[model samples]
Target: MVRVAERLDAVAAGLAEQEGPEAHAALADRTIEALRALRDEAGAADWTAAAVPAVRAHAVGALMQVCPLTRYAFARPRGYPGDAGLLDLIYRHPDADGALAEASAAGRAAYAVTSGTAPCAAVRERRRILAGAIDRAAAERPGAAVLAVACGHLREAEISAGLRDGRVGRLLATDQDRESLARVADRADAPAVATRRLSVRDFIAAKATAEAEIGRFDLVYAAGLYDYLDDRIAARLTRKLFGLLRPGGRLLVGNFLTGLREEAYMDAVMDWQLIYRTQAQIRAFAAEISEVDLAGANYWADSAACVGYLELEHA
Candidate 1:
């Protein structure tokens, strides 16, 4: 949504040179410059220590939508503003370090400080999506176990965190890297959320097996996981997760709206944002499930239909 509009705006801004492969690099550079400032203002708020993901979500969502690249497509874990490195490659790639730096510099510039409450309409919608995902799990399995795939640092999303902690019953958590989740787990006040490393094999497990590892969870969510996989993997992962749902279980996926500009800038349309799903695609996924509920209730004014989640239930 926002991505296409931004490219239009960018082309509008730089009509003369908005063409060729060079367009992506040029747009990337402009986006980098913008994100760096946005992040700096975010840092100044000192919320990174408390509302890390929210802050990131707000800053990044706003930046991504307004810019030419989709947030998730250009997303790098632990914070890259303009491109998601592949799961395994992210860990081994030497470029990972540089990308992190890129996130820092570019993210800061991209975000602008506002005097009022978050102007990005998407943030509140994201929170709602999170709440709904949690609620769906609870509703499906009265006492289904829960897990936190990646809690990140802020540790502020406690309701969801508590659900992951065994404190709420059976729970487990997994992350490609442990440090971030550990930051939440290590807290003296940390809830009893069981924690583990995320693995590719776990993705393909049967419903019972998945529940056995994390307990009988009625819902399996990939809040920020979309950014890590390509369309092939995304579809495959969706199929895998579909198998993990109990007869009536659901799997939820999050997508960023707008700002995947690497290709959209000058008519290139590079849709690399964490496997973005259109309304039609969501309808298709719904058809696969015994029941499907797709909601677009939450969105930043600037976001292009990315702040919603898809619910797929097994018969």
Candidate 2:
């Protein structure tokens, strides 16, 4: 812990003395490398509870807060760690311009680093993967019905070829956050995308007979929800989502992997914590589901190898 604090102090000092983006980048690199080494040395133990306060109490934490990306995540203005607005910062979406403009020069410099981390890159790739999945499902079955559970802003829909080309029959995006749903509803592709205010609890409680209420989907995905669920809820939700799939349909879920290099910084600075899982652990979520109702299951990592994806095909 002392070593970690010293490293953070050094980073704070460097950032204070530096004036340009290059200097900020160097300091960010130093901070990332230092935290990664400390995290690696600590191995796979849960230290977030102890580390977050210690890190935040340090000057480096205050310095990092200047960065809009870090501040939004730490503040969690939407009452959640990984809200859609924070994601917009990661996507460098035009919507974040206001926040970026309000940030200090150091903050913008920090944004350039935090927004370009490997995990952030993985998030960007996840969006692309989601869009591609929708396109493929639409190609396989024109006017395919799709569902995005815990869909945050549904930004991927903006770039989905299926939605843009009128190939998707309907896209039902459900979230607990009305603000997030409203953002999705405001998209130009509003006709193809429908927004519903639904929580994970509602889906977990959904009965098989109630499938008609929401309708079965050709493609169902929950890219960001699994990170916050425990083993029981994750498995239950897996079964529930799989049950909502039409014949030959696909259910894709993503979770951060155990070895994420940015885990420590995310925990300490951003105050963001995720339930990182191994590929085997992710696949195990389908253990309770009978093979009779399944076509196949596949697992892969994003380009940055920070996020793992499990794709289950319904028979």
Leading candidate by TM-score: 2
Q: TM-score for all predictions?
A: 0.50, 0.94
lDDT of 2 by residue, 1-315 (tens): 435577677666766766666666666667767777766665445355455566678776676787788889989999998999998999888898999999878779878998999999888889999999999999999999999999998889888988889999999999999999888888746487888888988988977676779999999999989999999999998998999999999999999999777888888778898999999999988987889998999999887788999999999
Q: TM-score of the candidate numbered 2?
A: 0.94
Q: On residues 164-248, what C-alpha lDDT tens digit does candidate 1 reach at each position?
A: 4433444456665666556546742435456676654566444665546555456666655664555555666666666555655
Candidate with best lDDT = 2
Q: How does each model score on lDDT? A: 0.43, 0.85
Compute the lDDT for candidate 2: 0.85
